[model samples]
Target: MTTPTAQTASSLRAAGREPPLPFAVTLDDGRELVMLRVLRILPSKRIVGEAETAGSRMLAKLFIAPGSTRHWQRERQGIEALAAAGIPTPALRHAGELHGGGHVLLTDFLADAASLSDHWQAVAGLPASHADALAVLAPAFAMLGRMHAHGLVQDDLHLGNFLVSGGELMVIDGDAVRSLSPGQALQADQAAANFAILAAQLPAGWDEHIAPLIDAWRQDGEGLPTLDTAALRERITHTRDARLKDFLAKTLRDCTLFKAEKTFDRLTIAVRAEADELAEVLADPDAAIAHGSLLKDGGTCTVAKLEHGNRPLVIKRYNLKNTRHALSRAWRPSRAAHSWVEGHRLAFLGIATPAPLAMIEERAGPLRRRAWIINAWCPGEDLATHLAPYVDSGPPPAEAEALRTLFATLYRERISHGDMKATNLLWHDGHVVLIDLDAMQQHRSASSHARAWRRDRARLLRNWPTDSALWRWLDANLPPA
Candidate 1:
């Protein structure tokens, strides 16, 4: 028969083995929680209180539990009562058999996540006479009142404890709820206490904020009292201490009111959107030209020369907004997609581009919604630089031969160089080179076939213009070698 310690070890391994054995575990990134290995410098306000494994949505609570059986029992009893009352609480997914004087519990994951506290913070930052934060506040109060009406006492009530996801609120970590006798006055007292907690943390002039909200909540509530405003205000001031006030103040500064749903797949819709925006910009002759030349040239993008893989490469950075004023507030996946598309085009076209080295996507930087594309450097003089002399010199035989092969290679492959300007072509080491291969498209259909053909024809006209009178001059132009 297996010893109890061996069974426990087997159970822990079955759950999930964390690194560094019996004590240390990884939470996120480099952050680790050392249960028994380290002496306390500062105790974690949040500790891993639960590791419930038997649920569709595995939940682990941090920093909420006081590590007492009483707390655990309170949570378990409250959950059962709330479910009976029809207020949504996480289905007691799984709770450890009471052992070592404590147990852990798990529940279903919440969907459609948005924090009421975050919404309030956004309101605080904006200069406004209009109190718009009530949009979320009224519903929040209604939910709380409904919970209290059902004879559920959430001992630990805070904004974070209530989660709103997918248009539903799921009360979590109920280790502190007290079940009141039906129709008891305890519900009202609990609600008043909870409101006081929220109100104290509210900014100055909160009376104006709460008055309208309470009125709205009262109007919608069933058999609820008309809220006592004066009592509420006094309670807020009396209950909110300096430490709590300081913490709420920090939350206001740190929290974001809204967050976009992030999808982690390699190719995401957000990334595609940015790519489309860039493709449009690159297609614009003026915008492309200006960017090609930097601000002095009035472009929407900037190009710099950089060294990579022992080669001189051109670096392209898109200016999402014309000025910094137009920058986005977060990383734009579209920017990443656009850079990836350009790099892919170059690689497919067999152009001399630096191996795309790395890309830096600034999701939440000053230039939010922006992306950077880096590639191996290609060294050579641009084709336009070499062609400018020949425009007057008349296409030299050697250069003309190289030009024919270059065009032939690209055109035969049914590839369209979106910006086929002469300047983007290069001449290096007696070989024709091409750079700035943005706005590339693969002609996969009949329409694209026609478009690609026309583009190639136009390029020939620009570089080797055959005078209406000079058939041989037209003939002199061949696809670039």
Candidate 2:
């Protein structure tokens, strides 16, 4: 059987012929269930649907692939075991093979529960206070501890596998759940590893809640091994960092959230939208750059403003500075790629930056030439411009606080802006936004990072002449050595 493409499924739905339901199946105990609405399409061509019987409403997972009955059996066993262990799980209704070439498992439908992933997304979008966020996530941490105390391991640790409703936490999709020996519980190391996997999927600022979350979990985790909170925090950070790197690499290569097309040999364009309009610009990037309103023009690079989809955008072209520079960059990745990746990295770290729309590069056989990175126009002045009038006096408390938060984030993340000039930092929407990210990178060694931080501080101080009040204020407020 051919798997259905999203487009085909959409077309079928438009014609009111998709989600074929109202199908009947007989349970192992001879009860009949009528599947009413398709809930979702699972991997391996299986279908999850809402079903009804004479007595109740249910959820039915129909496995259509050949030789999939064994999976249904495993899921049934896992759910039963988990429920027997006093864990919250969906009540299993029936499990059996369909007459024609499939297997079916039925369970009670969760009426008002939402997946943990969805809940997290919703809560993360709100302008909630730190205390509120901690309050929301404390229960989830406690639930994981309960599972570990009972020797239960959810191999598929995705947030979507857990559900929340009426102040209760429950686990779903039990196919990958595992158990230790009858009398055993999760060791400290195993429990920490499990928490790390789950925490890695939380929002970017989850690190702030780690201590409180662990404390809450420990309170409820009776009989569980004692956890080393520091070790668990380190493990969570390490795991999250690795995942971010992999995610950035994949996004750049595949333009996962953007549209990408190779318009010409050795010339590829990636954009957030309006591919046709962007294609015209990429056709001859130099001509487009020349015609756009110039923001900066230097021997090595050019920045310009252009309009796309009725919104202003800024494009920065990275040109060869000189013969030596051209030779050095010939076979290396374009600076455009660097900025694109760094832009995404900052966003993932919950730092503010201009939204990168697209990047275009011209390449020869093993040689990269001119490149351009386009960003949505940010509507605020640079820090230098914003603070020019304050040179004779100190910056206001709010501005000082913003600067402190920005530098503290940089210090904590080990990110160093090679050239930390005030002009490269924008004051936008009550926060600071870093731009020109080609020189931004996270260093590995403490010594190297410190060296970069010293340089950044020196550059920032030099923004004002000697004996300036702003400079003195900044020096006084600089992040501690």
Among these predictions, the greatest TM-score belongs to: 2
User: What is the C-alpha lDDT profile of model 2 across 144-241, one tens digit per residue?
Assistant: 77778888777667678888867678888878777764446689888888888778766445666577777766767678887787788788888888
- Residue 310 accuracy (lDDT) in model 1: 38
* 1-481: candidate 1 lDDT, tens digit per residue: 1211211212333433221222323332323322322111112222343232222334433322234445456666777877877777767665443222224444554445556666665564221225576665666666666665555566556566667777776665576666764553334555677667655544434554576656654553456544567787667666654434353232212122111122232211222223333333323323433434232212445565543233443445655655453444244434444544555444433443444433334344323454445444556677656665665455577666566655655665456666667666667645566555555555667578567767656764665445532224434564432
C-alpha lDDT of residue 465 in model 2: 79
Regions of candidate 1 where Cα sits further than 4 Å from its true position: 1-55, 61-67, 98-101, 126-131, 184-190, 242-481
Candidate 2, residue 122: how far the Cα is off, in Å: 6.7
TM-score of 1: 0.40
lDDT of residue 44 for candidate 2: 46
